[model samples]
Target: MSETRIVGLRTERGWTQERLAEVSGVTVRTVQRLEAGNDVSLDTLSRLAGALEVPLRDLVAERAERDDTGNAGSTDDIDDTGGPAAGDDAAARHFADAARSAWRDIALGVALLVTSPAPVVLLIAGADAGLVPTSVEVAIAIGLGALLAIALVATLHLVRASGRLSPFLPIRQERVRFGARALRWAERLEGVHRRQRTRATAVACAMWVSSPLPLIVVALIEPGRGQGLWIAAATAVLLVVVAAGAFTALRTAWAPYVQAKLAPAVEARATV
Candidate 1:
């Protein structure tokens, strides 16, 4: 009922929510809400306390604050001053940034699954032959499903790698206007705008480059005397264009030309 226990325990140990979450097997979001005394589940509190290297009873203990009746209010009602020591705003920010990156990863992964040659091919090809899947159509469906599975795993893992040490390293912005908030509201909002543009632009651009996938697939599926060579040649050209775009995405130079979008499929992972 009171976060004073959580706060007092955290302050005593000097652990950030991120650190706490790491040890607890609980998500940063859950740790955050618990620290606010939001009536979280017992399992969640057990994890949070474990992450803080404290007992659940210790985390639930009352702090110095007390009402006239000698009863303490809900910990969520406490001021920031009563929170973690050093008030580690940077730690809070990092948690938020990590969350933002996670959601972004999911968005991009979904987009990749949608845009990947496999699924796009099935949707475009299958709809034409009607929903009744044939043997060959079923095979195509299986491949498409596999693409989505791979994309999902990549997105989920890369979500953990958005820190300064992350591969898709963030630009240093100590004084930048855009930043994560303790509440994470602004982060989610901004991430949404960026993701929407990222998908729209990547799809529009990929559309131009993806024209050859079907052609290449056709050539491979029904290789004739020289069809494969023709398809391969066209694929090579598309690859060149894609490579250039990829470089631009890496350099963030494409941030403008593609309506301020990075490549949807490529992920930057943090080594840590």
Candidate 2:
């Protein structure tokens, strides 16, 4: 069957290939192939029809009618209003979800990293105070270490998963070479254009560098006679700076993907 009908129907409904694949429980690559006019099984067609909320016969019939009418045009054409195509909007929504998911994963990983050391510290303190038996403490320490290792691995996985969605986000190249390499690999997997990757890398580096400035300023400031007050002030500043930096990083990483998907609409508005 001709794929134009499927493409046309999907676009008309403002659905991206990714969105269709998700709703249809099919792989994105498979959707891409099917839309490229590759032959697919009836089961695949049925799934797609269900996802599109159309009957299988209607899909086939639409294609036949379009072929007979010879009114088919390129999907890239803008509408009469000069706005973005529905497919563009669909893409924007899909990537926006990915961006949100990536940030959430990052946040969860950070939380894991911050808490993973607590159990070890607690166990050591308990043993010193004779609250924990020496033998039991040793076993607990070993188990805690293993748990920490597992948490670290899970955190790294989440970070890598986020990198796949937001290839522009810095994965701490200086501190984590493996993570930086993973980010690069993810960028390639996501088919990020070379130009976009270069631009994103530059922006990410700038953001990462600037993010620490506030904390540095706090550190450099001379603490007056009240050492406790100074420490509290510095801690508060560090917390605020870290929170703001994380927020900025998330926004910066997500912006390009969102903008790329929305560019047509933005350009249309500008021309109008």
Candidate 3:
């Protein structure tokens, strides 16, 4: 094995240096020094191997090879300046994909919940204004039925999305850890997403705060002319705009939110 194989193994398993340190009962600096191709004790090597569930020889192979060749500067040896191992990229991609899925599910489910009452509100208002042929009592019944149906659908949607996101939840991913390369990647992605999320949230808030404008505008223009129908239309529009805004904000913010939530875990691991 090459000198950087320890880094390879740890990263391939999605274990950060700090994670390895915690599991192996060593310091994070020790893990870092070892990966930098610095010499460490046999006991440390044994602990690492055990923590990684690999044989001790796997951890010592590079040292053995170097001793045999009396080569301290072999080309295969990794120095502090070496680039990250291949596993880092794969881990980062996996994390990105997972976060994307989680956000999509969350946004869609909440959007459904938010907009579920729009149709019912419109139907009742239309009936009250004689805009619909149905009697007010029948319209109320239909609206109630529609409300129940939409609520049920929203519940199912949320449950299904939650199922799909279960693996990425904090409790399930508690033991999973990220390396420095992955953390840097996450930070960069978070920075880009933070801007998007902030913009989305601002837009959403503006939409929500302005949603009542339609009703006010219509009432001021003509107080009694088709007032019921106009009020219903305005309410329906408000629900839709608010739902859209919420979905946009949630979708854009999910990546940053997830990354922030994981920060404390990394910090704890480092201090360990």
Give candidate 3 regions above 4 Å deviation: 1-92, 170-173
Each prediction's TM-score versus the true structure: 0.33, 0.37, 0.63
lDDT of each: 0.45, 0.52, 0.67
Q: Per-residue lDDT of 1-272 in model 3, one digit per residue for the tens? A: 34488988899899988998887767999988888878665345545765777654556566556756877444232222222111224534544565677677777778877887887888888888888899888888898788788778777767655544443343223333445666677688888788778888899999889988987887787578578788889888888888888888888866775566455445544554
Among these predicted structures, which one has the highest TM-score? 3
Query: Tens digits of per-residue lDDT for model 2 on 1-272?
Result: 66888898899989999998887767999889998977665446545765776644555664455655776433222232323222223333344556656655665565455445445544554555555567545947664886679587757858655544432221111101122233333345345544544565566456556645654665677865544334444444444444444443444345454444344334434454
Q: Which pairs clash in model 3?
A: none
C-alpha lDDT of residue 149 in model 3: 85
Q: How many clashes (backbone N, Cα, C below 3 Å) per candidate?
A: 7, 0, 0
Off by over 4 Å in 1: 1-61, 64-77, 80-88, 116-138, 144-148, 151-272
lDDT digits (tens) for residues 147-193 of candidate 1: 66766665664554333112122112111112123224433444555
Q: Candidate 3: minimum summed lDDT over ten consecutive residues — where?
A: 78-87
Q: Give the number of colliding residue pairs in candidate 2.
A: 0
Q: Is 1 or 3 the stronger prediction by lDDT?
A: 3
